[model samples]
Target: MDELMRRRVYGADHDDPDPGPRPGHVYVELVGGPLDGLLLDITGWPQDRLAVGAALGTELGKFGPGGRAVYGPTAAGPGRWAWEADSP
Candidate 1:
């Protein structure tokens, strides 16, 4: 299976961060929901924006068309983010 898919299906240990991200880019792995295991770049975002997370629009979510998948930073897990909810 794909690495990200494996991690999502097989649990957290599969999140192997061996080589890590390219230099100068800040990435956070989104866990759960339709966007699970997707890497989001938050490189130049302000602290407030980072704190509030994002309402990302996607067609794959439970809400179907016009839906947004909300994800927020993982307080206990830096470099990772958690799904909050889905809204249409």
Candidate 2:
């Protein structure tokens, strides 16, 4: 599994620093939903609009960083988000 994906294997979201920066990973959560587990990071995307991707069986993505494309599953969006410490 990719380093990013590996970090998620723990089944628990880890703590992140800054919450906004290159060294930081993006986390995505629905504006209002019930499902909550691993908060998906939505930073990999460009900084401009709200990108929409998958999370907890829901389709949601936010656009940021101009227009980069960041996406993931909602089923894993809720808790604290952090990189695997060795993510490429």
Candidate 3:
């Protein structure tokens, strides 16, 4: 589990204050199981309070029990989320 945040480009022109560590994407990994070492890049979902939850649900649904695993945001900050399966 990892929270992928956009890094500031030193040469980019911008007027807004640095949006420090804004949530960009999440990388989920399964540990110690048949699905171990599998990685999922969950992004492009609606960026809202429920984005992570929605993404997790969608992925798990697609993969089923084997998809059961723990995950966390790529970065640590507000709105960051984590989930774990009952088994596996």
Candidate 4:
């Protein structure tokens, strides 16, 4: 195995198309309320798995494998955002 295969950011439940990290499109997270929109520049990511994994590590605050989700106040943005997996 290589360094790229070592990173696993996707949940066993998420099965969307492989939108590589720094994907051209911004990921949106709308909770509690809505806004005109919050955009974060993700142009620095790659169009492959390596980029996606790195991005996940940056957001999750670590570079391991699996962990539970932790949620903070509601925040909408263009970049990547994470919340408790059970958050509503």
Identify the leading candidate in terms of TM-score. Answer: 1
Candidate 1 accuracy as TM-score: 0.71
Q: After superposition, how far is residue 86 of candidate 1 from its true place, in Å?
A: 0.3
Instruction: Flag regions of model 3 displaced more than 4 Å.
Output: 1-27, 31-34, 49-70, 74-83
Question: lDDT tens string, model 3, 1-88?
Answer: 2232343321223675753233464444433333334444444545563344423332243366444444444345433334444333
Worst 10 residues of 4 by lDDT: 30-39
Q: Pick the candidate with the highest lDDT.
A: 1
RMSD to native, candidate 4: 13.7
* Backbone clashes in model 4, listed as residue pairs: 22-45
Q: How close to the true structure is residue 18 of candidate 4, measured as C-alpha lDDT?
A: 41
User: What tens digits encode model 1's per-residue C-alpha lDDT throughout 1-88?
Assistant: 2453333321223356643344566677888998886777678999999988888887778899889999998877877788999999
Residue-by-residue lDDT tens digits, candidate 4, 1-88: 2332322233322464542223243343312212112222334355553232222212332323443333323334333344434211
Using lDDT as the measure, name the better of candidate 2 and candidate 4: 2
By how many angstroms RMSD does model 1 differ from the true structure? Answer: 7.5
Q: Comparing 1 and 3 by lDDT, which wins?
A: 1
Using TM-score as the measure, name the better of candidate 2 and candidate 4: 2
Worst 10-residue lDDT window for candidate 2 reads: 79-88
C-alpha lDDT of all candidate models, in order: 0.73, 0.34, 0.39, 0.31
Estimate the lDDT of model 2: 0.34
